[model samples]
Target: MSRTLQSGYHRPRMLRHVGRFSPVRIQSMHYQSGRHIRLLLQPGRSLYDALVRPLQAIGVTSASTTILGGHFDHLEYCVAPPDPSGKAVIAYSSPIDAGASFMVFGNATLGKDMEGRPLVHCHASVRVEDGSVKGGHIVPQASIIGATPISVLVTALEGFELRQAFDDETNIPLLKPFKES
Candidate 1:
């Protein structure tokens, strides 16, 4: 209680938002069976295609994945900063190109978009050619893998599905777990 009050006082600022308050913070669920897949993201292919196509062929439409360290011929990522128009908390900057970079690791959530197609939301840390390390949201489709193959551990969610629906709280289309309909 004392620590919380001190921290609040130190900040002396309350972040303002443009939306109404909501009761729920974290919406989560569990499954009795977790389907696992050892996916190999082939070299010389877009990260999106490498992950999506093979999984699709196996009839896996939704999952959570961890991308192991690998290389990419051309990588594009974005940094999140304060929103310019104050519409929301933050917005992604223009895609930043990291030429011939090496991906250290990554976490991605696969879901269906509003159009009912595949969508991958991924954030990764990378080691750039200049020896600098950075992490951010990855543009998977635009990122082409290098000659070395990358491995990914995928946990497919059975019974239910993941969908990117318009989240009124965030005022964004975020991936949310849902019951299969």
Candidate 2:
């Protein structure tokens, strides 16, 4: 819902999540400098494999990546909406297919899940073949790269790592930076 102001501007209502508020609103960590990498996403591979395999080869497990414009043979993404189960604040909707789309840009976070395996959380804007523009969380494993190599700029985090742990306030597993054990 939105309210029109006297000044002729409209403001949308802010939706509150059904969860206990946490004292720590933003969970973040920082280092002196971040290691950078110019990565190329290879064609004919899942975005997950294209990112994880190469970065792991160089021992980079935790980082943030920016995916510059690129093409995909197939792409699927999901939007987040209020959770009906009350288990978490929000939940990802079912994957929406965007066939043969061109990725306008994307920001991805590389981390380790509870199982200690590589996990990539990526959000992107895409242009579908039919000329519709949409943006949402990208499904890396389902999205296949196109013929040309896609460029990605990676900022590797050092001294600390991002790990998914159960967040009590939100009652969800979220990635937070923690000092290396």
Candidate 3:
């Protein structure tokens, strides 16, 4: 904890994870020149499909995306809190239904899962119908887009693939870039 001498205010320390720390903290990859796409997320489609299908058609399977603000018919998200079990440092909580929410801003990553399926990892700040603002990991498959199209900026990763692999330190499947075999 840290204390302010004059004000006598004590600040709690940041929580540490229970798992063994990995030597490689940031597993990132870069490309020579990213292919940028200004995509308009089609209405009436799940966020997952809206992102995956069109990009797949363009041969872009790996990329980082920024989802601009837009409305959703329904939305569900999960927050990461301390794991109740001692298996990992943190775990995603059960999905929280944010009914008829407006996504204020979001960043999403596109990669291939262990089974070679498209996986979208998205986090967003949203405004619910009740006017409360919240943020968490967005469930793209469950969140349906509203009538209007949502704008997204996509930076396609090429020359290498983003694949999910098991990480020993975190004991989780994480997306990492790998050169084409």
Name the regions of candidate 2 deviating beyond 4 angstroms. 1-19
Candidate with the larger lDDT of 1 and 3:
3
**lDDT at 72, model 1:** 94
Each model's backbone clash number: 0, 0, 0
Candidate 3 residue lDDT tens string, 34-94? 8999999999999999999999999989999999999999999999987788777788999
Question: Which lDDT tens digits does candidate 2 get at residues 73-150?
Answer: 999999998888877768999999999999999999999999999999999999987889999999999999999999
Q: List the residue pairs that clash in candidate 3.
A: none
Model 1 agreement with the true structure over 48-155: per-residue lDDT tens digits: 999999999999999999999999999999999988988887789999988889999999999899999999999999997777998999998999989988999999
Q: Work out the TM-score per prediction.
A: 0.91, 0.91, 0.89
- Pairs that collide, model 1: none
* Model 3, TM vs. native: 0.89
lDDT of each: 0.90, 0.93, 0.91
Query: Which candidate number maximizes lDDT?
Result: 2
Better candidate by lDDT, 1 or 2: 2
* lDDT score for candidate 1 against the true structure: 0.90
